[model samples]
Target: MRAIKFNILLILIILNFSAIAQIKVTSNTFYFGTIINIEKFAGKDYRYSLELKSTETDSLKKIVIQTRQVINKDKMLDANATKDSVKDTLWHQINVSNKINLKAKEMWLYATFEGNGNFFADNLKFEVKTEDGNWKEVPIKNADFEKHDKNPLKGFLTSAKIPDGTTISLQPRTDAVKGKALLIKSTKAAIIWKTNYGSNRRTGKYCNVNGIKIYYEIYGTGEPLLLLHGNGQSIVDFTKQIPTLAKHYQVIAVDSRAQGKSIDNKSNKLSYDIFAADMKVLLDSLHLKKVNILGWSDGGNTALIMAIKYPEYVGKLIVMGANLNPTENAVEKSMLNQLKKDFKMLQLKEDAESMQMARLLLMLSTEPNIKVEDLHKVNSKTLVLAGEKDVIKAEHTKLIASNIPQSELIIFKRETHMIPNENASLFNQTVLDFLNEADVKHP
Candidate 1:
């Protein structure tokens, strides 16, 4: 019976694999596109065609079909649409032609609209012009929206945006040019990168701190809560936490020096102490005397240093996956070993980019030599957290927690260092609950 079930499962997998094709993109923005690998079609002429329909029928409006070919370092071919097509509700077949770059690795096909309205696309096709003058149909995965599953728009590459009245999905329509069509609707103008936390210019600002520029974004209104991301990461690492946390607190999400949009002097050696000092200067510049801080990984190490070295600036502290030292005893042996390997490789490369990365890796493997006795000096209420399978050893996390006068420790069962991203809701709520916990009553 087990053999029979296995056979059936294999057959289903084969069927699904062969039936893969098509994509749907839903956005309030004017454009949506998909990248196609055209390495085999290099130096060839090709035409891409698709059926388009829009609920908006203003005669002045048009839907432009465009193709762009990308090679190693440049866009070799670009074709723009000037025709005033897609002016009605009826399905209109549209096509655009372009020559693929001789060394092209990929091509982008896009549909751009001039005005706001509901949109539908179907019967997508791509053809390469043969040397003998024949148009050969290329196999496009699920070119028609015939699949009905949870992820119907699997092949379309679209960035995530806040659900601001825009939605895209596959729907069966009797009027569809084929079996089904992709429906895109919007009732509001699209705000690009609403959750693009780190790099969003609207919320981002920079300040000179200790000869380096630190980038940060502010959100919501209330008690200030500063968020610091792990090493080699940016403010975007807290993308899931910001929206929810911002509702209750003034979220001050910052990209640490040398990371994200923050710029650092290439000559300076990085350390958690340096990171902590950078935060101090930034907070001073913002005129925030005391604020709650939540940090992960290297950010967590910085948070610990802040609580120890500058207690006056901290109201509450939370740190996850932080260690007191860069040793096998503090971090899991495998990760420490891997860091050493990476650091060694980076040291051999003298290029500016390589040296910068090497410095970060070296710091990760050889610094943050915090003394356990220093933990006793932390005055702020603290929350020490780590995953059961975290790179930071469970014992080291307990050592840090036990030394602090008013501290709590939590070990997430069966979790790893990436719990912040893997189980963001739970992590966000945990941080909120800790920050919201009322102060202990005093006699």
Candidate 2:
């Protein structure tokens, strides 16, 4: 009877240990849209940041946190058994220095505990305090124990494997102005010129299209002329040409879906087609029947899509430095090098979608497989123009001209991709001449 009782007690202890060995954490659901502060906290003042907490006292031998991005690795918190403040055999607080910058949005924290010569805390508590005075607490749920693990915050402790329950918190910066000035400045500079474009010039308006707010500006009168800019530029890029074009036509320029002041739609795929659709929506909003389209480089591709997909809406098409294939100029090594160099210098901030669009333009421009036959479907009266010194080769320009039945090809002498801005007078004359000829011939 005595032996049986001892055996039963041992069984009960084993079961209790098993239950405690598993760790659990409680916190809010992870949200992608939640704004995270990225500024470092001011002063050397340390806050009692609770890295992990538990309901029951348990001996903790090790604690760690892990993250993918290495933006602020030195500021993380890590503690070992010797560093913990122990009150009893089971309960303890792992104190960490308050000198860490917790401003990055994407990061994770982890903790590990050992008791009775065995690991117990497969989970740990993670907490963070933002400059906005908001506290967030998260628990590491299931940690991987087989792979090498280290404390993400302190970078001191290493584990062969980590079980779940990793917590990450991003602290906002105290000074919002200093931390985000560059981005703000860039955005401000992009739209500042539009303020002076006169009463007819419409300021940027945010409209919901397919549940996304698209920023757009409209100017001019008479026939609609939608101007799409090249990569890395906004609608303000056309300030030099707008006053000229708006004199004869109602000029509308968009910030695409991600560039300029437009807010990106997470659900929508970023493509030239989406851009064209957004323009279609804009036209629908304005009650315009059809418009003349002009695009440069990436915008040029977008104009092509508008002409091809919504043929009735495109009365005429004007594309400059447009290429049906990117590789056509690759044979000339010097031109290829210059193109790559120029492409690298173009700067667009918070414009990931535009970068993707630029890549597509490069690919399409170099595609040897694309032929004039493929462009036959473009029905709009087209004027394929390029600078004499533009990246596009003479043959490719001719091919584009040949594909569109009513299209004419004109090369500006001593000009490049940025022909309109470089020589505004010459560029204006060419466009005016083409429009005059088209009006007489078609009308």
Top model by lDDT, which number? 1
Candidate 1 structure quality by residue, lDDT tens digits, 111-145: 65533567788877888999999999887776786
Best by TM-score: 1
- For every model shown, what is its TM-score relative to the native structure? 0.63, 0.48
For model 2, how does the per-residue alpha-carbon lDDT over 93-140 read when each residue is reduced to its tens digit?
A: 343334333443323232233321221222233345666766544433
Task: Give candidate 2 misplaced runs (Cα > 4 Å).
Answer: 1-202, 265-269, 329-371, 438-443
Score each candidate by Cα lDDT.
0.75, 0.52
Candidate 1 to native Cα RMSD, angstroms: 10.3
- Local lDDT at 40 for model 1: 90
RMSD of each candidate? Answer: 10.3, 22.9
